[model samples]
Target chain A: MMNRDELRTALIEEITRVAPDLSADEITEEASLRDDYDLDSMDSFNLASAIHKRLGVNIPETDFARLQSLAQLMTYLEKHPA
Target chain B: MSDFLMPSLGADMDEAVLVEWQVKAGDAVHRGDVIAVVETAKGAIEVEVFEEGVVEELYVPVDTTVPVGSPIARLATQASVTPASHTPAEPEAAPNASVEADWQPEPSARPALEVSARTEKNDRISQTPTTPPERLKASPLARQRAARTGQSLADVTGSGPQGAILAGDLTSAAPQAPAAAEPKGKKSHAGFNPAEMRKAIAAAMARSKREIPHYYLATAVDMLTATHWLEAYNADQPPEKRLLMSALIFKAVAKVLRDFPEMNGYFQEGTYQPSPSVNLGIAINLRSAGLITPALMDADKLDLAQLMTNLQDLTRRARQGGLRSSEMTRGTITITALGERGVDSVYGVIYPPQVAILGFGKVSSRPWAIGDALAARPVMQATLAADHRVSDGHRGGLFLDRINQTLQDPEQLNQPAHQESES
Candidate 1:
């Protein structure tokens, strides 16, 4: 099982990688996905696709927007372990 | 002594009205401190002090619509010196103009100082021109990659004759763009136009191809179970709350990254800097602009409802060209889906920092042996492009296996009872 902190950190690292402009400090639990990061619909799909390929978990669109922060994402993943 | 000029805040506003002054004559002010409030087309914004010194004079009155580049205030050093003559110079110049004039010293002395500075700056510029070596021309993308990484043209050994830079030169050089160009959205380039956005895609992809050491792996998985699960779930949910295949893929990817931490970091400073959160970036294909990858922060944390909302919001904004700078940064991995348009399999290029990229291709019906009879099933092909520097082909294959395993088992992805009850 993936630890919460490790999962959070991995997510942040991937975010910084794909979006080179964002720093780790900027990604917080309260950060809004669309408002803070400017991710568009297609970008979100691409993000999901990338994660699916790398991490092996499927994130349903029904759960996409609800994930606002690293902490929140961890809870969702724990409930729906791949 | 120097004059502080009111900066042109925007292109539309020709003049700014001074709202208030936060400093007074003789008061010590530091650079970056709020010195005054100026009203522009957008709204009132605080202007910061650009230099540290005592406030010597206030040139513009509050509420005055001062033209852009006009001096709003003056700063004085501890040593007393006569204020240089303004002499109807450029209208309303910054205090720096006077300092520049005073510092000119004499015409005879100016040449020696200028010559030295010029030589130093020229030396640096000559070291790295925009042009790439001969072989790099073969791949326009390679030349662009060299330019973006700020590799000293002189330092890169060209495989082609005439000591020209090549696509191979990028192997040893760092993948950082030269500081010479301001980051995205700050300035327009001759070759790349921000208005079209394709320039960004081309630049990023070129850089990724040239700089990232990529190793690709592919996997084909049965999508029938997941497809059935999604259809059943959507039937009971509202249209707005319906889950998308992309979201499901993202959730699975996020979970897997936790197990293989190496893929979720950037190779920097001779080491991989692991990130603290999982912010996924999605690649969007804008018809006019080739492609743009905007980020979704903390994809693992959102519920189905929130995911749908966020996805909808991001897509809406992306189509309208409303993305911000922050959205473009810090993605650990990338996922691309060809949806109905893609072929059965695709091997993506590895996006830097993050060691891998996943490509999801179109789902198709294929024959499979179930017991003794032949069965046709709908399946999708997934490809992984990983950075060879961090992960080998074996590990990359294993990562794909994990994703395929999760995707094949649809019942395991049932929404939690608590989550269902809350909804």
Candidate 2:
């Protein structure tokens, strides 16, 4: 199980992997990376899949849109640790 | 000995810079092996060699710009006696009635002679070049497999011909085939410039509107039953294996397209030629920057799950690069879905040469008439922008209606589509 700090690092890495254009260090805690960077539904799905593969958390398709920011993702990951 | 020439990925491509070689001189290669990766305006396309042979010599080195039809490599095939066998007269491929019209010369496309002349003019572009140390010796499938997983290649041993790592070896690279195929080391290649992409899009779209006379049509499909079917179907499946509402829509479109052949083919050389099979192109937008449509081969033949998987793979590759030449060039027809983000419906511009473009808007629960009383049902807006040269409103109308009717009985589409889709 990853600690909160480890979770943050892992989450950012997965996000960066899904959208390789972005630098992992620049992903802010509260920024809605989804809206800010124009990551579409497909992008959201890829991000969710990446997180699932890397961290073992399967984000349901219905909840794909709601995953807006890195902070929100962290909270969800902490709540449902693999 | 035969020459492997650079294929024109699309109409806009006049020349491309050879990015890297997946093969080397004196190396043996099979037909369908990726010999090189060429950087076009469409991005890096892993060009496949179509004949089995030993690599005699690689003429164009990496980073050299070469015209279409220029021989990049010389292959001593089964017919060739020696590496010095006289160069055979370049064969002319007749536009086949069965497959692949995307790379074939359309009305505005240049003739073979001109392409050959251009190839000769660019001969000076190549400098003293050799296969780089960074080039991987693995098969195309194996390289793709390696890239997708971010699995380190340092430890994997090659066991195939010339010790090339095969796809089977990567299976032990566990938790493989993850849906996110956004490959590692993506930073090595320069990103597709948004400005250049916009310019390319502008050229294609402008040419489409100016050359082809287009007819537009729209209909609202009550996806109530389809949505329900998808929900119930996905409930039992794993997250990665689940199907989306778009999959149902795509299946419906591909299935329905078969019934209206004129609406599912290319309008090239002042004539409309219906494709023998359905290569349903999906217009995928890259951020807000630009668009690329990579087709799913035999879309109608794929069941719901298969269709969904293919779509996912196609979009992932489209957004991240690694789109093959055939995938980028061929589009017997295209479907653009803009509904998810915000739009109620999209009336897309017909991607040139291909006679039709289907658009779907967001499926929303709206009040609809069921015999007498109005009930809340999921309704999706569907629009068709088709070539006036090939199909009129009558056939186009019937096509959209068939999609509506097909979605009403999603179970029929779920069955294994063993029946051939008549183009």
Candidate 3:
């Protein structure tokens, strides 16, 4: 029942929660999480965990590459809404 | 009553400034309670008590720099036995942080990092001790700033908790001081001052090189089976549940240490004392501070999942400066993995008291042969730097071989480790 923008906002909030050192503005929609924000494996894991916990969507390891960027992740989430 | 001494964090650490007392008199402290926070060359570390008892007296006041093994506090225990017993208590099976989520910061739960800026205005600055070897309660950043500006930390009054000088305190203390115009040679990298940290590291490494007679060993571990097993295991799970290469490496190193006890303990005073449990010292580097080797208690016993969780928790806490005294001091053996950063191999200097250090390089695809057929396989070079006084190159080579053999069978690692009783 959540909109795309709402999901994105929720995702950013979760990222901010896990990594307080990062600001919302720095997390771009199109840019890769690793290249833009230096999101390491642990950071990415925490982000995926937040998304899964919030959206109730089980993002498998194989699909991690698809969720590299915020836009890509949003698209994936929208295609398979929880 | 047993005296809780200021533990020696490392060989280079001669003394540490007691930052704040987490426990006061009459407080019933558990075996693993963080009694106080002490500031060393590596930064502020939470000191944990080993005995279950009530705190009798805080012998050393806050902000006092005391020597190693010097009693900082006295604990009233049930029985006055094992006077020199600083060994950590047996850890709980699974460290369920959720069960104790709402636990207050009274040193009972895991000692977390004191990163939150305390705005409590210090009223006891007026009672600053006017001693000769003048010690100041200042943050590492503040100390670096003072050194750079050529201003002494003692002159600036602190606004932080218990009158500890924060970086913000320095700016307000002397805004237009003559020192700012002429900067000292103290270097800083990306807002992180590493000059003092670098010096500390140098001293530790120097002492390690001087005292410990080291023997080197390296082996190319074929991690193809392990890598494939991990991939298959991780493919079905979420990102959070996925196992890291280091986790497997840690398990392998720990499991192998059981057979080769000589390489898994403290070497001191012309004698080597082997520890009953394998508490692996994981060397973690901090941006603000230097290197710290905190233990992942009973590493040989933990499964891959538990090891992963513990590793994640330990690394996170260590970087945040939330390390317990037991974790900081009770390392049976040390492991340094630089594979993630693209390093092919690492020859680490052994953290003294500990006999061996295991280093793992990057896992890369290389031409591997099975009898006659050649195929590309993921290969990793694991190096072992051991104290020659306790172990020779033959034993060191065998230890590396055991690690390689253990890693070959990933299913063995994933299996529920048999419950081993601690001595």
In model 1, what is the error at residue B199, expressed in angstroms? 3.0
Compare the candidates by DockQ and give the number of the best one. Answer: 3
lDDT of 2 by residue, B1-423 (tens): 666667767545556677678789999987557777776555567786655678887877665777776667777777633322221211111122122222221223233332222232223222443242233344334444566676544346543433444333454443456323334343333234344456667877888888888889999998878888877786665567777777888888888887788987777667777876778889887653367788897898897888988888887777656777667666688899998777898998887778899999998989999999999988899999899899899989988888889889999888875653333
Candidate 3 or 1, higher lDDT: 3
DockQ of each: 0.03, 0.21, 0.24
Local lDDT at B310 for model 2 = 88
Backbone collisions counted per model? 71, 1, 0
- lDDT scores in order: 0.56, 0.68, 0.69
Please give, for residues B85-199, the per-residue lDDT of candidate 1 as tens digits: 2111111112222222321112121121111111211222224444443322212222444446655444654433234333334433543443233233211111211222333
- Put the candidates in TM-score order, highest first: 2, 3, 1
For candidate 1, the lDDT comes to 0.56
User: How should the candidates be ordered by lDDT, best one leading?
Assistant: 3, 2, 1
